[model samples]
Target chain A: MEELTSIHNQHVKDWKKLSTKKFRKQTGYYLLDGWHLVNEAVHAGVAIHQLIGTADQLDEHRELFDDAKAVYAVTPEIMKHITDTVTPQGIAAVVDLPDAHRVPTQPLTGAWLFLDRVQDPGNVGTMVRTADAAGFTGVVVGHRSADLFGPKVVRSMQGSQFHLQLFEGDLTKWIADFKENGAPVYGTQLNPQAKNFRDVHPGKTFALIMGNEGQGMSQELLTATSDNLYIPMRGEAESLNVAISAGILMFQLNQ
Target chain B: MEELTSIHNQHVKDWKKLSTKKFRKQTGYYLLDGWHLVNEAVHAGVAIHQLIGTADQLDEHRELFDDAKAVYAVTPEIMKHITDTVTPQGIAAVVDLPDAHRVPTQPLTGAWLFLDRVQDPGNVGTMVRTADAAGFTGVVVGHRSADLFGPKVVRSMQGSQFHLQLFEGDLTKWIADFKENGAPVYGTQLNPQAKNFRDVHPGKTFALIMGNEGQGMSQELLTATSDNLYIPMRGEAESLNVAISAGILMFQLNQ
Candidate 1:
């Protein structure tokens, strides 16, 4: 394997560029840094374009190299240049982005999570992880939401991405697709007419829409839903954290 | 306001030492960094010993900080040295540790959250924030748990700590006290015999015990509880993130 030593090296420069949304969009790939995330990516059968690490780091994960298309050795400085973590873990990989093809309009089962403009990567990642744990079929990342494949989201999800299918497109179209199949759509709101989350039935296929950290679901999206549900809070605190509220609502809907 | 320009400044050195647990214990104060967190400490009545920042930084928040006990002007370099964030918000405060006596022995009303060995500061802080929103009377931190006043915990909790009473003590003793008050204790566990969280009748007065991130509640603690509840999951994931799980269970119980 060839070694990458300099910060200005072509490979290092290319890897650094992957951090931008435009680069990721053009290349259809994203970088996964740190040993844990790289290992999880490999375990999930994610196709790797390349694996780069220091000699010592590579020695530790030789088993991961068995199926890699290409492997290269790189120095600590080079790893830091390509990675976003405060302390680079001496290992990184470029994995193919999963195709976000729309699922069939029919035969959908279980609940789904719809995220609308939730910009925080950590919150987006936690919601995906929670959705997967609650048996949601897929996560639909709506307009202005954080990139599902971003480094921060990847770390926060803790490998739940592999278990769930992620869609990045029109939430309205997706909702219409599900509605045609008889799936109940629930939008979270603070309205008096909204039913309590627990009071709703969980036996049927459904989708729960979670909005941005500040502003919630858009009026157009909220009106599109079959029912509006609110999680009752007894305290004077204004609202629960978006991720925590989503988790609570998801679990309640599942149960 | 005194300007601290050098790393060797006695006060700067002392504040930097707070990175170590020993120094924090010795000084009877912990560091709170970032504008958001410093504001939270002030709002929580956590007793800010010193508000340290650059002139420009302090200027931005001057109106919100008229009552700060002591304000110290520092250079950017000095501010960076005393903070953990990559980009210091130019403000960090030293807050006196809350006396354990202040934590209410008896909750005025509603449920309480008992956290045991929750090592992740982020999870611990998120739990506190959630508890505040869920209308939990107070939060009890048990053995091996993250420090309630730690920087990371304080940041994640936002400003919820100010509104809720916090206790750090033996779990066994707290459980006994709850029992003496006739408040039912609900412990989260995976036992098949445990009732589903949604199925349990949420009484006005109860304490919900959330355990470590990796391990659920201890066997002894589980045995002491009046009821064991499990958040039902239908997917292949091992368990929900500890903080997310706590939020789910707490919301359900409060409802």
Candidate 2:
């Protein structure tokens, strides 16, 4: 492992760019922080471009060296310089973007999720993680939603992206595609006339659309959905958190 | 109404202490930020102890002053000093903690949620909001859980706390009480032998226990439930986020 200590080092400056969405998109890579996420990336066989860590961290987790393209031991200050969080974890990795696009898994034969402009990075990541947990085929991150590769979204995804497929596209297009293919496409909203979520039974193929945290799915997309359902608010809360709503729907609708 | 300019003012100093659990408990108060939450608190009838805001904030939100105990217009710097976030919303309130104790809404009726040591402030708050939305009787935060009065938790609860009942105590005791009363208490975990949550139809009344983010419910508490249910994961992620799991169970079990 190469040891680097200067905060102004070119490598350090380049790595820091991973924290921004623009840089991530330009470079086709993102930063993975913390041991668990990095380990998950390693397990999922993500191409690790660089593994940067403090001396102690590298010393304890020597096995990480076996899978990465390169490993570097850096001073704490240098490590901190390359990360955005107030407290930087000791180890992180720069990973090449994997092939994230997925659709018609087995040609329209599995559950999928479409997030419509869910602006919050945390919510976007949670929906992806939940979709992965529910055995969904993939998640379509709608245009205008939080950047799927943004640092916050990456952290919240908890490396689940490596486990399943993720795609960025227009939610309405995905809804249309599913509907055209004869698969059920359910758009979640607060429509009073929509059927209750409990009454819906999903078969093997479906696309569940969860809308924005504030302004829900675009009006056009909702109208295009094969059906719509609302989770009844039995209590006084105005609505369930968006990510939670997505999870409940994914699990309940998963046959 | 009083206008205060200095962050060093005693009143300002006292209000700043609200971010901590100890100070919040000792003063029987906590800070509420953003217009939506403060407005929700007002609508829910929670007694407002002090309203603090920048002059413009006060001007724009005059209605918040109508019933508050006292109102003060402070500098933007003072608003920043009194809040936890780097960018303060410019308006906030010091509110007396409302009575949060609850057991049976009508004695032996209504679904109740018990959170067993769920430590994330966001998770704690989301469960409260979900409990309110699901129309659960109330929520019981067990020992070792996140502070109910913490700022993050309060923000996430979003005034739902005022709409429904919330109590803090031991999970074991609450489980015993609900079981003794004959309302089926369902503890959610990933135990393979546990019945699926979907199979258990929550009637007019029952108790649903959600475990902590990392540990799930304590062993003793799980054993004391009327039954245990699992949200079967059809996908590969190890587990669902705690708040998402709580929301799913709350809606599934809410008759």
Candidate 3:
């Protein structure tokens, strides 16, 4: 019920720190902006540490107060300082990071997406969203890839993060684990040895590895995979966008 | 090459004006940032009105000066002022807009993408990038769609703007024109009446219509199409990202 007006307020400083990876790691929480994302977080039963909003936003979403732990009325300027978006949506929430390390005990039992150094946050987010829509088990963000919890990634994922298990770490070790459990690791490549993605069938379990935006897959990662697949491009384009390529591959593999 | 330090300098003022659509139109030029984008524009033979960079950046890419008309050395602060990107890449360019209207004079002879009210700049840019990779004839940005030359769009497209024709106008008129010229208009939808995208051939000449991010398509536009198609999704996602959906449909229709 307290109001935060000044830019130098301690609470405002802590909220702004969420934008940095170090602070997020230390606090185990990140800021979610906009009513839509906040609503999704609430629906997913995400623990809300605090709900901060401008007077107008608080008036509009007064119903949310019934379940919120704490609510504070903040000025538009203060709201903008805490949010990552260029234009603050007047509402923001601090939500706990879901325990991402808990992968399902069962092996990936459907299509799965493995990303290798896919640096663009938006692309990474779109791939996650598409993988969820295509019924994939989960998305594994590789060593050099963008942080899965980055604000842009969260926004682009459109709440799919709740539906999917996201893990970050050594992709090679994870691939070895997947192989040991009988899941085929399908790495996408431009070489002639690659099969058309459409030729693959959606089965009980499999992993599709999408590489970097420009560099493709690392040689070691590509060699370790069981199959190399490609989405046949009839056009003059050098390659498809990584996210789009992932979406098409997911659809074809699922079909 | 002249150095421009004052924010009120005539050229600096003009370059800053590019952030607005009206100025870009009046000048018949647009701003592009980052080394990758500038490299793309250079390779595409786009006329560079000015190349502004910090001393370090200019020193690194000195060879690029072989073709540049004018190169200006400025402080990093000045570079940031003329660029839309947060980290500016220490470089930005004002380049001529290609004559997109003239490039599509012939009837659309391959998969074409028609965007209807897709307001997200990133989505529009990604769609154009996908269209380029899929070898579509061109992309028609509807009246309500985001401007193709916007900074975020240019970044998301990843140089695809140079490879494809971008037309902006009324969707109904363009759809009717394509239909009359023997190109079937295929509108993507979720209705049962719509055929699965994989099942549709689209022959050799057709246009695929992707609707708004929130609302799929206008009823009038949907009714005007020659055929309706949907990308079959097996998962719990309500819908695919518009750009990803466009990619799926474009690739399928091309196939």
DockQ of all candidate complexes:
0.58, 0.80, 0.61
Q: Which candidate tops TM-score?
A: 2
Scored against the true structure, residue A150 in model 1 reaches a CA lDDT of 82
Judge the docking of candidate 2 as incorrect, acceptable, medium or high: high
lDDT of 2 by residue, B1-255 (tens): 999998889999988888887887788788898887888888878888899889998999787788799999999998888887788889898888654554434455687888888889999999899889888877888888898888889889988878877788877877777778778999988776899887888678788888878788888988899889987776668888989888888877785
Residue B93 in model 2: lDDT: 86
Residue B105 in candidate 2, Cα distance off native in Å: 7.2
Q: After superposition, how far is residue A16 of candidate 3 from its true place, in Å?
A: 3.7
**Which residue ranges in model 3 land beyond 4 Å of their true spot?**
A1-13, A47-49, A53-63, A86-91, A190-193, B1-12, B31-80, B85-95, B101-103, B190-193
TM-score of each: 0.81, 0.93, 0.85
Off by over 4 Å in 2: A85-89, A99-106, B61-64, B86-89, B99-108
Comparing candidate 1 with candidate 2, which one achieves the higher lDDT? 2
TM-score of 3: 0.85
Q: List the residue pairs that clash in candidate 2.
A: A135-B235, A234-B135, A235-B133, A235-B134, A235-B135
Clash pairs detected, candidate 3: none
Reference-based lDDT, residue A223, model 1: 88
Model 2 chain B: which ten-residue window has the lowest total lDDT?
B98-107
Per-residue CA lDDT of model 3 for B97-193, tens digit only, reads 6544554676557667899999998889888888887888788888878988878888878888887778887889888888899879999897656
